[model samples]
Target chain A: MDFFKRQLPTLLVLVLGLGMIIQYYIPTTFSQQVLKNVNLWIQIIAAFTLCIGITSLLRTHYTKIRLQHSGWAYSIILYIVFIAMVILGFYRGIQEGTPFRWLFDYVQTPLSSTTFSLTAFFICSAAYRAFRARTMEATIMLIAAIIVMIGRIPFGDMLSAYLPSFIPGFNDMAGWIFNTPGMAARRAILLGISLGGIATSLRIILGIERSYQGKD
Target chain B: MGIIQKVLNVDRRVIYLIVFLAVAIPIIFPLNLPVTLTEEVMGVYNEIENLPEGSPILIAVDYEPSSSPELNPMTRAILKHCFKKNLRVVTTTIWPTDGSGGSIADKLVEEEARIAGKIRGKDFVNLGFKTGSYAVVIGMGEDFKKTFPKDFNGNVLDKLEILNGTHSNGNSESSLPNAAFSQDARAKKINSLKDFSYMVCIHDDSSVFTWITYGYERYGIKIGTGCTAVMAPGNYPSLQAKQITGIIGGLKGASEYEKLMNYRGEGARGMDSQSVIHVFIIILIFLGNLTYFILERKKTVRG
Candidate 1:
């Protein structure tokens, strides 16, 4: 039972991981077929996993409701909406001109848009609190942010048009910041992330990372 | 309380109100500020323009409703361009079809195709939302039909005249359509991701990187992307790396694409509002800092 629970899974991962690495280099028809089949299996499994996820979410909320947890009313609302949406989806399908489509177009879309739009308000308040130039680094960050913000808009170009010729344009300065310093910083981060991903992948393949196997 | 204290402790609701007014006033009125096209946006325009007519182009719409406001205009503009150029479009969404993203793509494609007087399944097809994001992309590179056997409408690919030569049972080596004899061009079938002349991915998240890595890196396909303003900066490294051919970033980028198309749309109209909000936020930042410094100075003096 221990072997079935642990050793078998690890063995499968080791074999599949090595096979995938090998398949990338050798592009033979057999290797290509293996990759194709594996991808198809992933798609099928992903579809099933989505259902599992939905079930897990429902179960979690249901437990909260049953236990009468604080803010349990929100769970009720979630259940109501979830059931409504699922029924609508199954009943009419997602085709054009259905109640399902109408619910999505009207309720879900506006709710989502409103939620996302609220971030602008919060960002405004947050920036007001955060952009104070208390230190040299903060001041530099504030200045660069201001420049990039102004330069991205059409008003900046209009303002630049009225400015003197000797001074560089807001757009030009902004472009320089983005192209040189921004790109360099981003590439450095990407390189670090890539190296980290490689290291982690190797650990997972070698079964050194057993976190995904869950607690004993 | 002193003026500095009042300014420093201004109600957040007031800030929200001010932002709302700033965004709303410009939209209600008219500024019609001229938007200068950036090189990145122009790159996307030029690539689509330069593609031969009747060439198949894959468009992956990978954003949900929250980002629809920013990404929808881009999707519409790109579709309009593809149809205007007489290119074949195959659209799929990595985001769930049961969600609003799939419907948005379907409606936008239908609207644009109707405007262009293009026929369904011939000029354009929506393969709808598929599960397995990166895996789906990689699978499409190997075998397109295996990735999507049926489109959103449940129509079989084998029956679609647009995908005539794409079937395994048919002539596999036909050349793509040319402008002169496009009607009879038997070669305009897309069997895999490599078969497409170009690919566009309009997303609100980091899924564009997936397309770059899986679709472009693996198959050597040229790809362009559109992302929300917040996600745009993250794409700069990939853009500099030339992993992506071009980018249309946020509503601003959408407006640029509209300007290049010579068709004024919602994106162009929203620029004035966007400009006003940005300036308003900058002003708030300045005022906040000014008050903070004044208070600090007063405290130091008292000490």
Candidate 2:
């Protein structure tokens, strides 16, 4: 009984996985129905998962505030803003000309912009400190990155102007790097990732891994 | 400290300012660079082109404002194609926070539909933000009406003319009342994934891959994805294996798609900035490497 109980979830996952895989080749009416039902179930489960993630985030912050932890003050602020956003979003729609819209327009959008904009800062700092040209590979990568950057910006043209007129098509060269070499590198990474993803997913379905059960 | 050390330890704020300028100046004064269309992008285009005009296609927007720069343009381009093809579009978003992102797509299609004199409830419908994630997407494949239950305005499903054969499926010849749309539509159209002709997912998240596996593997419906540039490369193998028909990565993909559709929208404009910015990043990487090489050589000599 214990073994069955432990293995039940994995077994069900496998059966569903196999069923889904089989449904692809056979173009029968019944197979289509099964696929639809499976998709619906996935959507339902995913929706529930979203709530769980958001709730946990709230719980962690709120608990910190309650306990008055060393950084509890920041937690309190986070919780307040989070809860306020939720209330405004759910209770009052952020329709045009509404107070919720104001909150969304002024607070949410700006804050989001600010957050993403900080990526530029972090990228530069990391580049300065971590992007060492210690090896041939590193040196090549650094050169590619810099050429691509200059080729992109107005400064590239300005810098090129100072160079002897013989170095033609500096901007075009940068575009070529992105469109060709950069694309090739990115594609290679994607191919590796996809293979890894397929392997990982298959492993989970075949019961080769049970870490999701928290006993790993 | 030392003179060289002080030079290397330039103010962190200065770095931020430089990066800000790199990303900002391009936005302010866009470039008119040429954009080359890759086979990957063309693959996505060809897949949509081959589908029958009136085929029902599910368009899922699975991202939010945070990823708008990359995703929004892709979504718009897909919407343009679906609408132009006179394809029956079922637009839905997995995340509620991405309602605005969906709105961006919605507004574009609506404007186009209006210009072309197409009615909403009849020709196309915005299913809006559904609460479920992968479940909702899966459920949609099974039974769109059951999963959505209502349109964005909360109108009851049975009443909607779009589902119940109230409107003819684009081609006047297929005007047969959609008896398939009744509650039985779920049971009939979806059992496994083969019921739909194609599914277009514009997302930045990973879980959407389940749709490719579960939907494509089971149903035989071709899957195409549009994702942020960062997420694009990861889908390459899937494309290579032909599990996914095609992918549009980042703003550039969106721009190419937009041009293909003959609809020059935000995507086309965004490309000018994207191209310039990409070149800027390449230069920064080069400078950093050059500085490192020089400094390393000096250190080695001293040693």
Candidate 3:
């Protein structure tokens, strides 16, 4: 059982990972064919994973309701909505003008949009409460944020006209900050992430990483 | 208490109420704010503009309804441009669909197609809700037909003439009304990620990374992006690196695009409100810092 669960997955990963890496460099028809098949398999397996994920979510929420956890009412609501959506989806096939589509249009979109829209209010409050220039670094950050905020809107363009021709305008200065310092930092971070990802991938492919099986 | 103390102790509700007013007032009274174009936005516009009519371009609507307010405008503007230029559009969503109104992508795409008088399976197609994110991308890079056997409406991809657009000129196989001769027969032989003239992923999240990493890096496909304002900064590195063609960022970016197209849509209309809120936030930040500094100065004097 240990070998089947542990060794099998590791071996599969090793073979698949090495194969993908090798085929990435190879431009032949056979390599292309392998890549196509592997991608299809990934999609299929991902579909199965989605099923598993839904099942796990249902089980966890069901248990939470059973135990009458602090947020048990929310769990019950979740259960009701989940089941309703599933039933509607299967019954009406999610086509346009269907009951499923109606729920999506009226219920889900509004709820999500309302929730996301509230961020504007919260951000306003947070900026008022937290944005203070106590130190040089904080002041610099504050100035940059202000410039970028102005640049993000058309008002920045209007404001830019008022500034002297020699000095960079709000939008131009903001773009510079974003492209220069911002790009440099983001590039460094992305390079670090890529290197780290490659190392982890190598470890998994070499069978040196078995943490996914709940044993390192 | 003191004025400084009162300023410092201003209620959070007050901030919210003020922001609400700032945003709501603009909506109630139209400002018709002038939108300036950024190079990032202009890059995307120019690329589509320069492409010959009937050129196939992939557009991935990889955002949710929450992002609809911002992202939908970009998608709509791009669609208008593509359809107007007579570009054959192929759309797909790699985002999790089937739950929580994922078909909004389909609805939006179909609406644009309908308005443009473009027929499905010929001028446009939506290969909706594919499961795998990066894997689907890679699969498309290799073979679009194998990746999506059927379109969103369950029509066989084999029957979709839009995918079989000419490599030389990008015209469909059936361009003429009563086709005497179809010289674009080359399209029948080759269809993949690289075959499309360009691809723009209108996304709210990090899916552009997958497109850039796998789709562009591996397949050599040209990619542009219409991303949320916040995400635009994150993608600039990729832009500077020349991985993507251009970026349409946030509502402002969308409005710039709408302006470029000489259309006044939701994006153009919303600029007044968007600008108001941005200026409002900046003012709030400034006022907060001013009160803090004054309070600090007073404390120093007392010491």
Candidate 4:
């Protein structure tokens, strides 16, 4: 029973992971067919996993509501919204001109947009405090940020028109910063992330990463 | 207790008020400042312009409503350009949250197609939101129909006349010019990722990485990206690697695209407000630094 619960999953992972890697190299019809079938299986599994996610969410909220936890009202509201959306989705369908579509467009979209727009206010306040030039590094960062901010917009181009022709304009300097130093830093980070991903993937395939298997 | 210290320690609410006014006033009174096209924005435009009329292009709308303000303009502009050039468009969304992202695409495509006098299933098709993210993208490379049997509207892929000349057979033989091409010689059938003339992803998040890795690196499909300004700098690596052909970054990029298209849209109008907020932030930064330095000098002199 223990083997069927834990070891079998890890064994399946190893076999499937190795099969996928090997399939990528072999161009035969059989290999291609295997890959196609595997992709179809993945899609099917993903659809099932979505159902599991919804059930988990419902369970969490239901427990919170039943226990009368602090802010349980919010949980109730979430349940109401969730059930209402699902019911509407099924009743009128999710197509355009449907009630579900109208709710998504008018209610969900505006709420999400409002939430996102609040970041600008927060960012402004945060920047005021954080961009202080207490050190040389801070000064350089502040200046670079200022240049990039100005250069990315139309005002920078207008300012460039009046400046002396010999000196590099804000737009030009910002472009250089983005292309050279910015590109270098981003590439280094990307390389690190890619290497880390590969290592983690390999660990999972080799059964060294058993965290995903959960405590048995 | 001095003015410099007071200025340095001003309440955050004051700062917020200033920012709010900075953005609001610009909307009421337009700046009409000239927007120069960046090489990055132009790169995307030029690539789309270079494609032959009726060539199939895939657009991945990988953003939710939160990013709609920034990404929607780019989507609208690109759709307009594609339809204007008489290209066939195939759009899908990887976003699965309430499926609003797919709906956004449908709404925009419908409006743009109506304006362009293009018919659905003929000039464009919305495959809608498909699950399995990278898996579905990779699957499309092998056999697109296998991954998406039917579009968002429940129309099967085989029956879509717009997909007629595409690689339906999953063989190299389908690459040959269709004999029936004379009827609609402009529209080419798209069978795989490589079959599309170009692929553009207008995203607010990290799905562009999946497209680049799976769609471009694996299948050799030329890809461009349109991203929110916040996510744009992160894409510089992909741009430098030539993994992506070009990028339209944020409202500014959208405005530049609009200028190229000679269509003034929300992106252009938003720039006036964006410019003001940026300048306001810069001024605040400068004032903060100036006050800090002044207080530091005063402290040294007193000592």
Which candidate comes out best when scored by lDDT?
A: 4
Candidate 2 Cα misplacement greater than 4 A, ranges? A1-51, A89-107, A136-216, B1-7, B49-53, B95-118, B164-197, B262-264
lDDT of 2 by residue, A81-113 (tens): 777866876776544444655665566656775
Q: Rate the local accuracy (lDDT) of all candidates.
A: 0.84, 0.67, 0.83, 0.85
Ranking by lDDT: 4, 1, 3, 2
Over A1-216, each residue of candidate 1 has an lDDT whose tens digit, in order, gives 878778888888899999999999999999999999999999999999889989999999999999999999999999998889788888888778889888888988778988998898998999887778989989998999989888888988988988899988888888888888888888899899999999998898898987888787
What would the TM-scores of all predictions be?
A: 0.95, 0.73, 0.93, 0.93
- lDDT score of model 3? 0.83
**What does candidate 2's lDDT look like per residue over B184-287, in tens digits?**
33223322235556788788777457677656764567889898876775676677678888888877788778878876566667766655545545555556
Q: How far out, in Å, is residue B6 in model 4?
A: 2.7
Kindly indicate the candidate among 2 and 3 with the higher DockQ: 3
Cα deviation at B257, candidate 3, in Å, is 0.4
Instruction: For model 1, report DockQ.
Output: 0.76
Candidate 1 ranges beyond 4 A from true positions: B97-101, B165-178, B181-186
**Where's the lowest-lDDT run of ten residues in candidate 2 chain B?**
B183-192
Candidate 4, which CAPRI tier?
A: medium
TM-scores for chain A over all candidates: 0.95, 0.82, 0.95, 0.94
Candidate 4 ranges with C-alpha deviation above 4 Å: B166-187, B300-303
- Candidate 3 per-residue lDDT, tens place, B279-299, comes to 888888988888888888999
Better of 1 and 3 by lDDT: 1
lDDT of 2 at B302: 100
